[model samples]
Target chain A: GIQVEQSPPDLILQEGANSTLRCNFSDSVNNLQWFHQNPWGQLINLFYIPSGTKQNGRLSATTVATERYSLLYISSSQTTDSGVYFCAVAVYYGQNFVFGPGTRLSVLP
Target chain B: IAGITQAPTSQILAAGRRMTLRCTQDMRHNAMYWYRQDLGLGLRLIHYSNTAGTTGKGEVPDGYSVSRANTDDFPLTLASAVPSQTSVYFCASSGTASSGYTFGSGTRLTVV
Candidate 1:
């Protein structure tokens, strides 16, 4: 079983501010993903990065598989971004995906 | 296009009652999964099916059961619900295990 830990369990940011959320896993993973659980509880996929960097709109994510950690960057945050961001990982030999506690972000206007 | 749809957005059931959570996907994905999310706790996998007719237990499958009789539907059953089973259940599907999963809106189940 792999342990996934997310940093800054809770975050409050002013609209237009930038923030970085981190996820560290106990072991190497074959799959890593960042998801946003919206106010309606819909899990939307943000990024699927096992390694390397990717960007979509104001969001970007970087994963260092060697270091066993990943980072998600949200720039110019908006009020609609107020929700929980989760990181999930699937280890090499594991059939189940494990998720981090999540980073609860509250973007205040 | 209904990527994935879960039946009964919310449910209230008495303890010891049997309930089934239905999930269906129109994408024709080969894999489907069931997970439970608790407050402050991350989603925990309950069961998954690689394809039709093949199912496997996940992290928390003791109190739950699932069947995948066909590619489009995967249903989870709680034989005897308990208070501890109160949580939000999410159903997801993927083309492959390494790909990103498409999740449903989720079903909020409460056992009293």
Candidate 2:
């Protein structure tokens, strides 16, 4: 089983601010994804970056597989981005995925 | 299109009672998963099915059981509910083992 650790357990930002969150895994992984759990508790898929980098809207993520770490960037944050962001990973030969503790973000309008 | 729907958004059950959380997906995905979210600990896998008729235990499956009789349905059952089992449950489905998964809205259960 792999262990995923997320940094900055809690974060608060003003509207239009930017922030970055990091995730570190204990072992190699074949699949990695970033999810945003909205206030209503719906887990929205933000990125599926096993490696390299990807961007969508004001969010972007980078996974350095070799370093066993990943980063998620939120630029020009909005009130809508206020929620818990999670990073999950699935090992190459693992049957289940592991998730980090998550970073709770609050955006003040 | 009803990508995924979970039955009984919330439930309050007495300890030692039996309960089942139903999850169904219309996408006909081959892989289905069950996860539980607890305060501070993050989401932990309960069980998963690679396809119909095949099941596997996950990180925390001692008090939970799941079955995938068909491609579209995967239900998790708690044989004897306990207060420790109280948490938010989420069901997810994916087309393949290496693809993004679509998760249900989640089920909040309380065993008192």
lDDT value, residue A104 of candidate 1: 94
How many pairs in model 1 have backbone atoms within 3 A of each other, for residues 3 or more apart or on separate chains, i.e. clashes? 0
Cα lDDT, all candidates: 0.93, 0.92
lDDT of 2 by residue, B1-112 (tens): 9588998899999999999999999998989999999997789889999989999988899988888889999999999999999999999988876677789999999999
Candidate 1, lDDT over the whole model: 0.93
Q: What interface RMSD does each of the candidate structures achieve?
A: 1.9, 1.7
Give native contacts recovered, as a fraction, per prediction: 0.74, 0.68
Q: Taking the candidates in order, what DockQ does each have?
A: 0.69, 0.68
TM-score of chain A of 1: 0.96
Report the TM-score of candidate 2, chain B only: 0.97
Worst 10 residues of 1 chain A by lDDT: A89-98
